[model samples]
Target: MIRVFGMHNIQPLLNKVYPKATTANGVYIYDEYGKAYLDGSSGAVTCSLGHSHPRLIPYIKQQLDKLQFVYRSQFGSEEAEQLATRLFEHSPERIYAHSFFVNSGTEAIETAMKTAVQYWQEKGFPSKQQFITRWKSYHGITVGALSLSGHPLRRQRFESTLEKYPRLKADLENDTLEKLTEEFVQVIESIGANHIAAFVAEPIVGAAGTALTPQAGYYQEMKKVCEHYQILFITDEVMTGLGRTGTWFGIEHWNTTADIVAIGKSLGAGYAPIAATLMTDEILEPIKNGSGLIMSGHTYSGHPLSCATANRVLEIIEEEQLLDNVNTQGEYIKQQLNVLKENYPVIQHVRGKGLMLGVEFDPARKGFQQKLIERCFQNGLLVYPSVGGPEGKDENGILVSPPFIISRSEADELLAKLDQSLNEINQ
Candidate 1:
């Protein structure tokens, strides 16, 4: 029998019931009792290629046969180099020239933060150490990334730790586009723009029910603000990259490029733990001209096996033309969600781009979220709830990000399950 070796009372993602062990192929997961469930949310928006893709295992095995680890500081491997080249090729041309690999999204953010600070110091602006980020955004769970994040629930326990740092002004929902731009400009000015190192944000906000997309021309305006202040614009694309948003990167949808881009989740297609921070030549020039050494690195920074897995994942995406599938399937999902909104008065909002959609429930309907989850689970579907919002507020929403390989029939199946769940919950 499988046994969990932790406190029995510690809660899991779902509080009402303990999860059962299971196994399955592709996008399906099985419970201990042999019940199959479709992974509609792609396991918190990872698994873009789906669970246990046959190609990934062979590639990983091939790499493991050669080498597993290569110290980033002293040693390098061909797999890492090839993966970096692939990432650069896939990104906007002339934007990302170099990559720094890490084990997770949080680590990538931490690396990006340090790189920004060092870039300023090397460029003779030593006082430019402050970072700006938006509210309801998630960078990662590590200290540096957490410090840059504005998720209230995640920051609740560590408030004091962040209070001591240079605080970035948080954006509120009620703020109009003009108000936001004005406030952002004023904050940079007040802080002495030259003293700020970087302004970090997710192009399309995730975690907080996929929040609001920037207003039309908002990002262009923000880029101007950053350029005016000589501050680096770092886009956290951990959740929105690799065709998840019907583009190579979500920020690309806005036609804007960031100085530094942190990618994870779909980077390795959930087959392995690997992340990368890609930066422009301008950003790297300072470091190259100065110390010529990246001050941050981990032992497994360029693990060959993970790199191999990621490389294969990218190959599969391109070979199969998954981006086209994402665009087509994403449109269908959006259309279905809109229909759901029309049918269910309880669905307060249906928002998001591509496969990364969110369905926010109205609080007036008590027990809506729990009932929704239960009904969905019973009907062989799974989704994740929003990370923050008022308790019992039904700020609870479903994240619908199925694998890129999902077929039209599978999409219909998901919609049927979702409709059945919503209808049952309404009763």
Candidate 2:
């Protein structure tokens, strides 16, 4: 008998042998040996519906049998049209009037970047091409997205090839809204707003900032500045979109809207690979009147199967009223985390909205984040690593964003496992 070895994948760790997941159901992933691992971070905060969801399987199978692949320019699919309509209906009113589907978060961001540039071009300002971004953000992995992002580590290797976009080192958490808005005006003036196309930022900073959330009036003030300069405002909601933050859109928490929005992660709910670039009618109107086309898409931009899978995912979220569960269980988890923070000096801060929570460790105790992650893994729990500290480069944080469908009992179990992991690391 001949044994065949499958091709090896280039994972984050090359020298380590990670456990092999054979099956997964709900919030737990089972290894080949039948050991179950709780999905604490929802697979990098993407799996909002958990694993092997029974409801999703039949829907996917049905869609697979009906229609799957289709070229974007060749034809149109109701799956894509309906998904776009659903996203607009759920978004903040007067916010999203159209959606451009893509294969990944990075593609959605790249598409958004192009759309913003084109929006300015159609308005007869071709010099409006530069973008302004904060230092504590991770937009995407593509070249164009990477150029706009301020994530130091992710941009290190590609620095030479990336564009020299201005990265404002403004403190969203500590600075007053007035100071923040002033800083924005200063940068816009310095760069000459006519040369800038958009100001891009994450609604709540995700992996790069450890779910760092700004003050109540932050977005409102910032949006005002962008409008004053005639610059577009784009929010990267890849991690917080589709009810992850207890709202249809994370920016809705502040009652602010962006000119362009990028949504992914939970849109497919771990069942498919999909993302989208959403824009307001004001954004599309100028381009539609001038160029008659926005000029962004991929061969599989609107893959029918992926669209169907994502559409059903949204339907289930609406059907089950999962946003309510996210709020209820998120508060319970947040309250429990605060108690843990009181007991443990290592847990310096806890912040974020709904289920998209983050725990920042004391910077003085370096590498404590990885220690806790390994401990959590040993205890059959999982968590996503994040960066924190003044510069936002230190990996001293962890995000605890789990699936939205998590129940109170499951929340207790997750908290217990996390508590145990923290205790072990403290020892």
TM-score leader: 2
Error of 2 at 84 (Å): 0.6
Off by over 4 Å in 1: 1-17, 163-176, 364-367, 387-394
Candidate 2 displacement at residue 111 in angstroms: 0.7
Candidate 2, residue 343: lDDT = 87
Check candidate 1 and list the clashing pairs: none
316-383 per-residue lDDT for model 2 (tens digits): 99998999999998998999999999989999899998999999999999889999999999899999
lDDT of 1 by residue, 1-427 (tens): 7776543666655455666646866778888899889988888788889887887787788888888886776788999999989988988765788999998998999999999999989989999988988756778887778888877777779877773344344343445667777878888888888778888988877775344456566677789889987889999999898889888888887788999999999988777899999998999998998999888888789889999999999999999998998889988988999899999998877777888887777766666776787789899998876643442123466678889988999999999999998887677
Off by over 4 Å in 2: 1-7
Q: Work out how many backbone clashes candidate 2 has.
A: 0
Measured against the true structure, the TM-scores of the candidates, in listed sequence, are 0.92, 0.98
lDDT scores in order: 0.82, 0.91
